[model samples]
Target chain A: MPKLPKPPKPPSYSEVRGTVQDNVIWKSIFRPGSIYRKGYRDTSRDRALAAMNNVLYHLHPVKVKRHGLKLTYTYCLGGLSFFMFILLTITGIFLMFFYTPAAGAGAEIAYLNMRELSTTVTFGALVRNLHRWGAHAMVFLVFLHMARVFYHGAYKPPREFNWVVGVILLLLTLFLSFTGYLLPWDQLALWAVTVGTNIAGFSPVFGDQVSFVLLGGLEIGPETLLRWYVLHVLFVPFITVVFLAVHFWRIRKDGGISGPL
Target chain B: MSDEVQMDQEVYDRLIGEGKSERIARAKAKAAAVRKSKIEEGATLGPKPAEEATKALEEFRSSRSGGGGVATKTAAPADGGGGGRLTPEERAARVSASLGNGGDSGSVGVPAASDHTHRLLALVPPAGIQQVQSKQQDKVYTWPHLLLVEFVALLAAGSLLLVASFFLDAPLGSLANVNEVPAINKAPWYFMGLQELLAYFHPAVAGITIVGAAVLLLMSLPYVDKNPSAKPENRKFANMAFTFFLAFWGILTIIGSFIRGAGYEWVWPWVQGLGFVL
Candidate 1:
């Protein structure tokens, strides 16, 4: 029998071969090895590699114990807190574009900016609300996460250091909220911060100095607004990010979420 | 194979750091390697001969029972595991070896599941995961399990905030006038607890001493309690104490938030119209 003509073989992907398909535009984006090969075994090692190789996924363990994954056990309160932080960061940046931290006239410039943001700027109110609510949610969720950790006795033994770090994060969260409280320069913001700073004034030794430093003077005025604006925008976020990184790294060091004994 | 051996060494060292016996650690590493090799050889490669399977199971069982292993926790060094007398120098050597050769310094904290839990839940893999032998428990890859859940939560929380933002603008009271402070001025809900404390004690006592003491106590909990176990049942006293603290915080916050009238006076929440509810 006469042999049929052989079909052409596909060229290889190597640079040496210089295949047309290899130089295709899409190939540049989704390179080989980016996705796992088909029929890959879900073995323990494979799972470990999957987690270790990814950036975001690296926060989690390859194979968590069933007990640890239970919604009731963790309630994902820590995750919620983290999500709120991300939301606040994004919305806070959006807010900074419009807000002016100046104490001008009866209707303060800051208050006018806020009013404009709420009533005029497109989706401005949404961004402001998200920031406001996210702040509240983060404060609530951080405390809830702490409560969950306490209830589960997860702060014991190998996990002790992480718990201490978490407590510090909680304090940082409150400071973030308090510093942010004065940003709007409204009656609510003014009196709330005054009440808060006045408490600082009662601290005996450094009370007056502390309040003075916080207000940038003895009273809540332009200096106070400027000081708070810098704190809310620049200083607090930087410190929070640093501590957050440590808090997460320590969790990975102390073992995945604590489970049954 | 070399990579697996390196990983095994890392695990063994970590276990040792957690106070496990060398013998038990070796057995666990061996069992894990066996499981890995079996997975690498696909199930279609053919079933294990009955005699070999029986022998493997018997060896695994013996190694576990003989080496003082339990379901969830490894044998405690102070209790059942041998090598409780491991010299400090030996431990330091093991730590250095693991740190040097493991190549996994940054990759710690994987909780190897308890053998009993693994065996019982080994029947079915969680959704979206590739199939492996059932010897491992019902495990799901974290990509889908954790990250997916987090993404969904982000969307849920974001949308909720979106709707809320539309209906309820963030509160911005009239422009600041220090001389005309609102009659019922109060701090945010969170600081309301502290504000309530201020009403009861001197500002120094309430703000600095009491609040500072609470924070310090919280930070030093693990050191102060000294309980090694993570189980809730074993931590009743600590739980009760925290519950009381939370109750105090909650009640004080409520008083500061709602019960206090113009002069920070106590008024039943019902006295105010339901419209006063936040």
Candidate 2:
């Protein structure tokens, strides 16, 4: 290829290398500067890059001051809620490899996993059990976390956005618990969900509209299992992940946790 | 103005007076001024629609207006830390710095004894300010203590649930025949509160009001009780009120679960009765 002409540059001004006495304004909105440094190749690193280049990331600081990361400011309950969630996620995935969602086979498969596959997996039942309990624990912890945050006034200023996000997380948690209730495909799961979805239908604004929508029928049937199974396994988890991102980000942006105790 | 500023001003004024120079700082400013004058010249004297007025108000809010004013001057010292924790070296240094060479220095920059004490007290603010009140207030998870508790509790609950699931086996009644009504048709524990409501009130009211009230309380709690004084001792009134509410709801839920007949009308009535009785 033939040599192409270089684009013309702006005319140069006299360079002022040394510090000047006057504070002259430098308007350089057009040409941006590198404002961030790279970090360890973990979560914070992704955050820092995101903070600079992304509004969503910018909402949470890439690197938190060690002081803010301390558990006391976080009110342990929220952290514990997250801990339970991770525990649930791990246990849930393991349960999935063996457990089927089909009404006929779901509970049977779960039983087989507990009796047979569990022996080889060695704490496999422990895993399924943990996942099951973790769901319940998550609901309890999330409620307690909301209470703690509420009483402490931690949900006010700076943390308001996160509080809204937390509400969604709480709803998702309840969803997670409810859906997990059905995985065993037992009567408890069946009735619990039937009652739960019926209550959902009671929403006056939507009412019967809501039940038919979620249950996929006026009453619980094969459709309910498949629906709750999909929601528990796929849908709610996806929504929870999105809200979780906003939740943590808002924490950092809300001034790296609350203090002035 | 300084000599340089005056010189620059006169040069600029002379140039402007001669109509040879123009100055409106940014392109945005120039654009705004032109539009403003155009509007003023052709302005109609009429009341605007509410929506139009709202749009105007929003446009005003979006514009950045900078002006002159008094700035609040409560300059905090570096390291907004209170004087609580102390190192030997720091303590010695601070004492020496305050006392000043063991009284050799005439004016140690210390105030009257009362004033000195007040200043120091102000820094630490007694036990009231420094203490976070409840352990929950600190929110810090001492991992070992917390994790152990979490694991144990979760493990225990998990174990119990598993055993219950196995032993109870969740009563596989007929294959969920919707057409055949199961006698004593009832809701689960979690839904018991609402189901009990459906018995008395319209399902619309039961669903909307009950859940709405609970969600409103939970979500807007931070807004409802916005006091910053969360110290347990300081927040005694709020703490007590909250505790009472929690206890009331908890007691009612348990009781309502059993006496499903009255359908929660008694729950609120009793709570109201207690208020008047007290």
Candidate 3:
């Protein structure tokens, strides 16, 4: 009645989204050809550019053999193994924050922390469980992946070196799992590691030296726990990552995802 | 002074006999002398004859176009079209017309042809340059195709793990007692196979020899099996050997994990209850 100024029309969802995507920050984050970029179309050029521009390009090519998309071809074992490794790393890091590596007769901080994880901490027990199960799954998946590669005879010619690298990666995965097995600082952890390391101690020569270095003493003591914690969290993972990089790089270089056979 | 000039006397005399100008004859003779000297020195000639080059280019073009007849001809007619006689402007117009840019004066200026320069009508043979024999593969874009599959796989694995984690708890036995030991002390399930081997073989043999041999054999598989074919039927022996190894290890792991009890003795898992924990 008083001839008041009309309110501005609200922006549509797409309009607001367009404005957000048009900004410098958004453009910087999602480069041209990114699926997330503004005005992205489902074109061959954009699809290829998306893969090329993303960090995933390191692991995947812009196009893959059509046969590789078949679930039966790969069972996605290799990718799952890598994903499991990443999951374990995340959960392991979470566990590491609440737990201590120290262990002895009077000082069993590691064990106490584990108990606290179950009883006191939120999602700690779940993360621990995930880490444990994910580790076991990774070992299994890596074994399956090796078998898949072998059965396909994907190890011939230019792939032979990659297969060797894969073998190294498998061994490293096992070592990572073994080192981590000792971190819970419980009877299961201690005895399991004892049985495993006892096998290592039976190596032809340098047996005692190997055992000593591995256990950090005559037996699985406080020193052994600390040594294994460092190995599990730092040393073995570092080595595994380096080998994993080579393994993945070789997969792409050796002509991407083996064969239709 | 004429004897000291680096010109082929025979070529000079021949061109002179053909009634060529003194400057043109001398220049042609000098080039012929240089070419002869290079040939004598075993220096390979750079460009092949136009006919040979055209043949190679035609072969390459035919192969690229699915092995049909030669595409459009680039070579000028031998008798009628005097490529050498054309002025620079005329040459530019001819090139533009041949390139299907006819009457487009806006096209970039073509480089003027020099007196000695020949028009490049033939391409280097693709085979001679680079023999990349990549067969066309049936492929799909990785974004929606491969990345989608990968994302789904990751989600499936993550959800499975999450559900398992939610229902089950990770085992945590009593504080590690150096004094007392568990009766059924076992390694993790993966190493359980090796531990099972320990019961049968001597420690050194089981731990070092068998394990080392297995790893060495696995690593050397590609090199050892000289079978180039990936077909299962073609590589029967390799497939059989690897299958045997897998079955052997798998059986051992199963036995170690489920069939072992106190004192690491064989016991039915159903009877003794599982002596294993994840």
The numbered model that scores best in lDDT is 3
What are the per-residue Cα lDDT tens digits for candidate 3 across A1-261?
Answer: 699888999999999999999999999999889999998999999999999999989999999999999999999999999999999899988998998899886888999999999999998889999999999999999999999998888889889999999999999999999999988888898899999888889877799999999999998899998999999999989998998899899899989988888
Candidate 3: docking tier: medium
Model 2 fnat?
0.19
Q: lDDT of model 2 at residue B46?
A: 50
Per-residue lDDT of candidate 1, residues A75-102 (tens digit): 8899889888988889998999999898
What are the models' TM-scores? 0.68, 0.50, 0.76
TM-score-best of 1 and 3: 3
The TM-score ranking, best first, is 3, 1, 2
- The lDDT per prediction is 0.76, 0.57, 0.87
- Model 3 regions more than 4 Å off: A1-9, B1-130
TM (chain A), candidate 3:
0.96
In the order shown, the candidates' DockQ scores are 0.43, 0.10, 0.62
Candidate 3 residue A150 Cα shift, in angstroms, is 1.0
Off by over 4 Å in 1: A1-49, B1-139, B274-278
CAPRI quality band, candidate 1 = acceptable
Which number leads on DockQ?
3
Model 2 quality (TM-score)? 0.50
